[model samples]
Target: MSLPPDIADLLAPKYGLDPSICTGPGLVAATRLRMEINGLDDEFSYYDQLRQSGEELDAFVEELLIPESWFFRDRVPFDFLKSWVTESWLPTAKPEVDVLRVLSLPCAAGQEPYSIAITLLEAGLRPEQFSILSGDLSPRFVEQAREGTYRSIAFRGEDYVEREKYFEDIGEGLIRVRSFVRNLVSFKSMNLVCAEDYADDGPFQLIFCRNVLIYFNDDARRMAFEGLERSLTDDGVLFAGHADAIFRINDDFGRYGPPGAFCYSRRAKSETEDVPDALPKPQSKPLPAIEKRRRFFQTSKVAELPKSKDPVRLPSADSLTEAKRLADSGQLEDAERICRERIDTGPASADACFLLGEILLARKEVADADAQFRRTVYLDKSHRDALFRLALLAEQRGDSREAGNWRRRAANRAQPSTSMTNSPST
Candidate 1:
């Protein structure tokens, strides 16, 4: 099913989404689901509702938002982040700019920003020596990030022993990022596509916008890159996703450090000369000045979501552990039983729902498994593992749009932290 062209037109320019991406089957189904859930009887009514209600529009966009991320996902960048701070940034930082300021745009559910804090700490910078600002387009993600709690699934790198020291294991397979790391970072809800939202935040020394920008069409991509350039200091470093292909945007930045690092430094006459021949250097003419930024998303485009005062409760840790052990030991029935019992006796448990979903999948109850995964997300929006499973389920059922949505959601929550093998040098 194709999304209404009018709706696509409404969303694409506002959020910087590729118009074509809005036409996916999964997205179409999700759109209809939103319409149904909101009591709209037809697409026309849905479009009208969206036009009239910013909260409804945000909900529709939230369905498409990807928040996939995990801690220290791709290790090379963190290694480079630490090195750049200690070896490069510190030596030349002006006395007036004493504190190292970093920004992580689209920080997902806080994994990337927290990872930055940990890297800075590991680099011997005291918490007071550096500050981090993490932002995402989704308010739900920003709130989740501020909570500083996550499932163990959020950690995927081999440095488990080292990273473990910075987390305290809360019950039910969850961990809370230590206060020392959490204190160094501030979280905010922001739309980077809106230049006004971005203009006030930076001139940052280092910026990590990794794994974003691949979702934009040409116009949005250009605008996004220009915004990043405007926010970066003259000599500051900017890290991008490998697939972002920022080199194609313009010669404004030259590759910094090694290839897979996907980092760029503002192109100055001397700096451009050091860039590899693969990226042709610009002529010696002075770079053009930045234009005044434009603001696309306006005040009327947003409405506050009502806050819930209820506290969340999860299944006991021992119950979750036993369920995992039973499932691993080939006793899926017992595991499923324990999960259901937990759900019945306690407040909704995302952990229990996720585990039951896994068990159902193992039992080949695909439809039931999908429902359980959905339930897990309903309980905890930032459950990366559940989102991943939902994506896999969608893909297996040949619903590419649904799979893409789920994958993007999971991808945003996970940071790509490990070194890329056999990647080309920039």
Candidate 2:
């Protein structure tokens, strides 16, 4: 009993989990299971050909593991961690406290754990004072971490001075992490999803598990969070993806964020005695005329465009177009300022409103962009651009039905107006 040739080829080199381990009727089942676990679709067209080439299989596995990450990714989270540790966690530590353990589970090729090491070093902690446990499921990634060498291109256009201070040029366009930073981190191969993988080496103080849980289903997320809770100390904090929220998942953790990123801390025993209100309540008021107009567009099929009044003194249409051009060129803050000034003078200008929404969307201010799009639609129900953008936002939030509806409405409104010619009366 032999496995499918393609399936065997795909799993052999990349996972080092031999497909030949299964025999007889179990081969197909094992192959399908491997595909599912690796998040590969069952119907890959090139599955047959790809299996024969170890290179192709390795490339596919590489794609699955190489998630988007960078040096000091999401800077706000690091800043918050630094302040929280110095102002809150460190002060609470006893003078004789021998070790402060921080873990970066599934640390990938080590960018995140290394970033944590640099942060601790910058905060005046010596390598001996703290230990970073960096673990990953991939043996290849673990080996790479141990090597601590990276292509200079990985630095991108980052500050050259910081790179010089932290990295030793290892030649051939590779730079090695300084020993001081490298020494703080211990690389190990551990599968986070396994129950009995690593011994109880922690009551870890901080765990950076960013961007890993987004791939998980709800059940897997619950299991991962439970594992994290068990691994953490009473006062431990867990940092997740910037876009991910765990507030609805468990009451055991409290969510906090500065300006850009959100994190969770295990709820303290004292918190049970005095539960703080999590969200602010909005004061009730009657909807303004503009808001009412916006709501009407949202709920009603009738298109009602706002009438222009007295040629309102607004920025030239050129300025609005210029702002968009600037924004597309990556001058975001500048574009936002220009659009905001135009909006201040002529609040009903849908073009300006839409431009502002584009800038806000680029900045990841989804809620703000949603409001601006609503306003743009209110001022000009035929604003197809705003409707399309709003539809995209809906799609991003997983509201496919609403997204389709909005897109249909936008398409209807964007249709070319009919023109008529009549013969003169005889």
Candidate 3:
């Protein structure tokens, strides 16, 4: 049996939430909660309230969107992404001024975008050379993505060592993203259904819309694909979910790799006729330049991080503070230069090496940055960022054993380091 027509119609069009899969009891339970909150007992009354108030609908949408994402959820696409960036992307890029723009729509609780940032970092692209723009239909998820923190469950299948690399265990099992990875990604609230949301934003180098299309009806899927097509650059690639391979539907994209990978490259427009959409497309135009948000998403900008009163602090920090300031201020060259100077003037410094590694990362210099990060861990075995970067580098290169080893090492070091002072014979 299907949902009552009104509820089904209301949900399907706006959010592409298929009634068939979402099932019955789940909808009833969720709707019941809304009814209780609004003091409406009847289903139709609640549906009326949903129709009358936009806020209620948004909240309902949030309830419907269960974000089930993990870093590199299925490893193949990222492996493909790493290969594409190195083999296809970098060679064609104007690295000096043209930043590699990537978009992750529905950046639920931020895993995908953060994964993108970390993956790109692992690939050794400098922060300045790439920028990740993440958006979600739920403002709440968008805010969460901005904060860049996660619980241990977020890293469940992953090695603990890998977790130690990008996150700091503030307390409990919660972890916060390091500034290096966080800096590369920007989060915004967007409705993929509303074509206006992304009209002005991109013709991105890469776009990830994984696992979302499964919920959409045929027409909604077509609309989503069309919108993606609009934002994707002629040479850009789209990363999709495995279960719903995009190749089955569209003539617009040529399958880039093996089945289950879900990566596709846009066909030359001339080679393919404009793919027909069941639904009418939204008219898109550029928005005013002034409306664009240029500032980095700090705690205040979006402010929905899982709050920790007692944050864990690591030692061996020095010019990194200033270097970070320079980098954030867009003085990347100066940041790199000063970090190098710090390394030169200092005694075998792991902090400086890590900083240089980060600087090199923002520059998209992967191999060099990998070397620096490796040296960092050598100089100071407890350097978590370096350890994590090494893991990412290994993972990208398909070295699961090395990645696992580094992850294990990072996990070991994440525990509070104990100090032993030399004393006169006890």
Candidate 4:
């Protein structure tokens, strides 16, 4: 019952479900039962495999639906959510209408919805004033959400303290959520891609759909957007992944705050007129020279180059060498500043760009780091350090294919330099 290669390829991109799960011995009986139920022929094509095999299809669906989330996964988005609820949404609510509904679709084992509940509770919303509707396609996750149990390993950083405060020891390395937060949320099994079942719960004021859309293809993304649009109130706010943007995907939404962050709002009539009909114009000035120097030391590689012609420029080699010295001496911010200053003086310095990317990546400014890496590569394709860093960033973002491509390019470029040294002709 081996699947055709083309079918596997098509399915692979959409869902990271391991194909071996289907070919495995344990699933054979289940697979056969599924095929028979759907009246699929033995000689059926790849699409038929998807239609016929319930077990395999379930595995695929699970991949698309699961998301990695933790309590307060990204603080900024939660902070904004808290502020908006306290200052905006709550004030606007009619006093006569006591129930404030919040829905976390695909709640993914309950961390997000619980986080929302905690925020509301902290904001002084009484138990009756607010309600959390948490849903997911996985019955297992839904059950876990109901139990509100978590292992110590699932709690990280500040979450460790929060977990201890909000949960009671239930034995066996599990902790049960306290009554206060638990009472705020109601768990249900839901498939967000199919929204009819939840139509009665419509028009949420705020929807936390973060980090879920990255799994979907364009059409699925569109469908999800439409579903959200239908489910949201007119002034409702939707929060998506830090890296995700609706600007390119949907005209119905508008971006807010600085670029490349989770802050966005529903498109306003006046805002729509302000959006340029074309791509945003590029920035006029080069990044600061100090920032370039900061970036250079972070990577610890000098771009191969004709050095800058400016005589007043900080001693080029010494500047980088000193920046590295400062970095090793535990002066990270200082080293970064030096790199930035170096880049501002001249745009051709890929060394500065690579260093800046490294510093930014270290600081957890991933999007900014990614931009610096792109700049480094654009300036010098042979920049191995930039290529390596870009590969690492891509891998972190769950894009292994892009990671592999960058790694291969780096390896190929590194090879030629090594090969030339061993040649006798030189």
Best by TM-score: 1
Worst 10 residues of 2 by lDDT: 417-426
Best by lDDT: 1
* Deviation from native of the Cα of residue 250 in model 4, angstroms: 1.9
- Residues 1-426 of candidate 2: C-alpha lDDT, one tens digit per residue: 344565754454334442323232234344455566556675364465355666655544554445545667767677776776566555555545546678897777787898888887777666676888888876788888878888865565555237777888978888888887787889888866552454366657678888665445455667666667667654457777633345546655655434344566644323222222121111122223333443543465532112223323446767776776678777888788777656643324777777777778778877777767766776678887787887888787665766787799888984522111110111
- The C-alpha lDDT values of all candidates are 0.70, 0.62, 0.66, 0.61
lDDT of 4 by residue, 1-426 (tens): 444566555554444334533332223444456556657656354257675665666654554334567787766566766666676556655555646667788888898898888877766677877777878877778888888888775566775235556778989988777987787888888766665646567656667787565445556667676677666554456777633445557644654322222544444334314322111111223223333433543466422221113222333656665665665565668877777656633324677667666667667777777867766776688887778887888777665766787899999884321111110110
- lDDT per residue for candidate 1 within 177-197, as digits (tens), equals 988778889888877776566
Order of models, best lDDT first: 1, 3, 2, 4
Residue-pair clash count for candidate 3: 8
Tens digits of per-residue lDDT, candidate 3, 216-324, equal 7778878888778667654567888733446545654644543235666644334323322111111123221322322221112322212223322222355667776
Which stretches of model 3 miss by more than 4 angstroms?
Answer: 36-45, 268-426
Ranking by TM-score: 1, 3, 4, 2
RMSD of 2: 16.9
Clashing pairs in 3: 124-366, 125-364, 126-361, 126-362, 126-363, 126-364, 127-362, 161-407
Give, for candidate 4, the lowest lDDT window spanning 10 residues.
417-426
Each prediction's TM-score versus the true structure:
0.63, 0.55, 0.59, 0.59
